[model samples]
Target chain A: MNEPILQVNDLHYYYNDNQAALNGISVSIYPGERIAVIGSNGAGKSTFFLNINGVLSPEHGEIFYHGTKITKKSLPELRKNIGIVFQDADNQIIASSVKAEISFGPMNLKLPREEVSRRVNMAMEYMNITEYGDRPPHYLSGGEKKRVAIADIIAMEPDVIIFDEPTAALDPLNAVMLEEVLEKLSAEQKTLLISTHDVDFAYRWAERVLVFCDGQIIADGTPLSVFQNDEVVKKASLTRPVMLDVYEELVRNGLLADAGVYPRDMREFRELIGK
Target chain B: MSHEHTARSHTGRHHHHKGGHRHDTGGSSIDFYACHSRIRHWNPGFRVGFSIILLLFCILANHPAVSCVIILTAAWITVGMGGLSFRRYFSVLTIPITFILLGSAAVAVDFSRQPIGDFHLYLFWGYLYLTYESLLNTLFLILKVFGAVSAMFIMTLSTPSHELFSVLRKARCPSLIVELMHMIYRYIFILMEVQRNMRISAESRLGFGDFKTSCYSFGQIASNLFIIALKKANAYYDAMEARCYDGTFAFLEEEHQANPKHLIAAGIYLTALMSFWLAIR
Candidate 1:
């Protein structure tokens, strides 16, 4: 709507033997939009994210950031603007110490020492891990490591952040913490694009949903609309969120006169059902 | 949850060791292992200085008594201050002693000329005459190596690896070498774990039926491990790049400080080493 910050056109990718990983996929993301790309395993969701960050190039497609086509020549500049967080926190952390890991991104930009120190402190504070600043990353708890990894990228101040299954290995509590962080990042006007199999996470955090099935986008809309479409959900090999399923079942049984349902959480679902 | 709990326990143990000084306010209840862990308190400059001093001593002095005294002092410091157990101390000396024995055997068999006055038959292998003089010379050689190795280990066991790297960095060690050292240290355990997994997998597959097959399986496992390590390294590098990491390296803090007691002990060790060298000469 307001000068799309990212545009992917006719993207086609493959892993091996020309088996299409992404088939003519097109998506546009604006600044400050929380978009979730949901799909089952081997559905090319991760491949799409990789192509967006220039980590993996599509055989036939064009990716543009701010109307400028991203090329090998401009990848370094593009990457500086788009930070991708890998799923594994262990793989993302490069430095032995927490402080050094956070400072790594700022130092890569070749910022002055004072500015680097300031940004490191700011990023640590943002992640609520100032005390862990002196601790080794390997020694920190998994949640703490994940926070430090996020802080490492946050220090870079990327305009667009990509997370690949951020909550895949996290406990419910840690997953909620991750969602809060993502919400905060989105609030800061950072374009957040996450690829996840967790429908609940997608439904809770994403304003727009992209459902990938057999290396193609079958549905793209608000989370509620996407989940309500049984055909699309079945095709994508995805299940509706529990609350959404319950609401649909209630509507099917003619228990609710109105089918339109929007409940933020389980408690809200109970209240809505009572009404 | 158990894994997380164990990881937390390990972290807690390290933190406890790190914060041991704060609770031990009495100053009399000193734990040498805790003291060794606080080798971070030692000055990087001093570590480098003493390392250079030891290097020079090794090059300039060769007397058996001097080397013996140096070796003995290093062993004492490692055992008393570094908190290395007797078994570990002996284990560290074992390889050098073995090499010395082999060298002495070679000298006895090859050289007919007597280097020292004492000539007693230590071992007789047909025409191979193993003399006591040659044995003593071998022991001296072993002691010299022991002194140098023990000195280096004392520095390492007392000082944290990160501080040791800092000392190396300040000594104008090549950035590439320092980085490689850091990376190797960080990933060696990972590689070892990978190797162990491969071994376990191979064993599980019953690939070790005969000697030849076992060797073949071992080679396959090694090759597979190498490939996996390379893939992991590449993935790790990509992950690092995603986090905006560049070539320059930074550390948490310059933890190594100059403690007066450590310096005094180091000074005493150096003085004793020099006096022994002079006395022997």
Candidate 2:
């Protein structure tokens, strides 16, 4: 069995003036797991990620990071391990320049200056943002700012990085760039938890998908199983990835062969169709 | 994806100290070059100290020659040693010149019922006149102000604002003020971006389509922007908290080894400036 890096046991959270955001949520995240969290708006994905990141203390239940229960004393350690790239880069970016912004997370870890510089350089080079090092982050393009936000987490060299709606406001070209960056990070064996409503993105990128509906995990399985389950799709308010839907339609019409394998992404789907 | 600043947006450019100074374009220009400066990582203490001493010399010296020397030296360091463009250097000086010209007008000509002892007299019911002393003082003040402004601009043109704030903190400046300065520097850009987007959206909706409507729409946008800005403030706080910010300074500052050669050069310049001041006084 894969060792769980993050575990939530009956985790519950409620806003002071609103309904329960995470109602008894429990999930175990294995090391290096590429988990895509899918949910409609107000369906508790953000709340769950926040709890795991130690941004919010759950009203009830427990969250364990690397088998250690996350308490106030352990919150800092948990944060160092679980970095979050917020939906809006403008919000996550607090430093004036790109270098300072990326250096922030490492400095927060209280790392030595030399180590911080090395990590900052590595992350910037990884994200292809070395040119923007001294430029004010506020003046950067949306796509550039997003890269800096990701680099901010990468500089910390976190064990797991959570991206909330990573491609929400990104244009198609920049969106592709972001996915490539995520792919590179994943290849390095860093666990990734991305909460997004982009089904095509989730389908192509994620190995495991967790469907959330009304503050509960309605379905959790391989993308094919969870997304193809009609009841789960309806409950989660998610449409199937376009490629998946089209591939299945072709097979249903006897125009294509399944080959006993579900297509994982667009390239695979095309291969399955023999086109 | 379009990283361009929207045209004619009502950002902090029009609201902050020194009107029409844009946080996006104007401030970023200095910040851009400052970051790219060849000696950007030089100890800010030497830079700040040199600038301040030059500024004081410009004030204390009796002759405009001293101010002229100080101004020339500031321009040389910023444009030569720092590698800032000569065009940009000239352009930055224009800012202080505008105010200095406006202010010097008061001293250049005086109004009096009996016509003050004079260089020139013009009738404005009674008389407007100028004296040799007042004229000299006015010219001297303008030169002094320009010299001081140039000296300070050397620091601003070479050192990024955050680094300057970092230098202040190292000098045992109040943490609250330094932190506030840092946050304000960051949020100004945020607010400016919000302003740009709001402007573009408004313009798309015929907000600035006509003369009267444009005025009305601007007022509405301003009010709406205030409310939204407040909401963004709350969001910013939450975002800060997520990053494990504990109401403390959490950013990294560059640690540069103070250059002994630069310090020695600064000392030489200080002596030259003092000798100039004494000779002129």
Scored by lDDT, the top model is: 2
TM-scores (chain A) of the candidates: 0.93, 0.97
lDDT of 1 by residue, B1-281 (tens): 32254244444544454353332222111121323343434576776577667756865687777766667766776676556665645644565577766765665553333343344343333233555666677667666666676666556555544556667888799988887876765565356546655776788998888999899998998899889888889878877655545566654444446778868987887787788678768
Name the regions of candidate 2 deviating beyond 4 angstroms. Answer: A16-18, A270-275, B6-29, B36-41, B81-87, B119-126, B209-215, B277-281
Q: Write model 1 residue lDDT over A1-275, tens digit each, in one string.
A: 68899999999998886699999999888999999989889898878877787777789999999999998887777778999888877667766567877877788887888888888889999989998775545456677878888898898899999888888778888888888899799889999989998897788778999999989999999999999899999988898887677766777889876646577577788788787
Docking quality (DockQ) of candidate 1? 0.38
- In terms of TM-score, the best-performing candidate is 2
- Candidate 1 segments whose C-alpha is farther than 4 A from its true place: A14-17, A71-73, A96-98, A124-145, A250-259, A270-275, B1-36, B63-126, B158-169, B201-217, B240-272
DockQ of 2: 0.53
Taken over the whole model, the C-alpha lDDT of each candidate is 0.73, 0.81
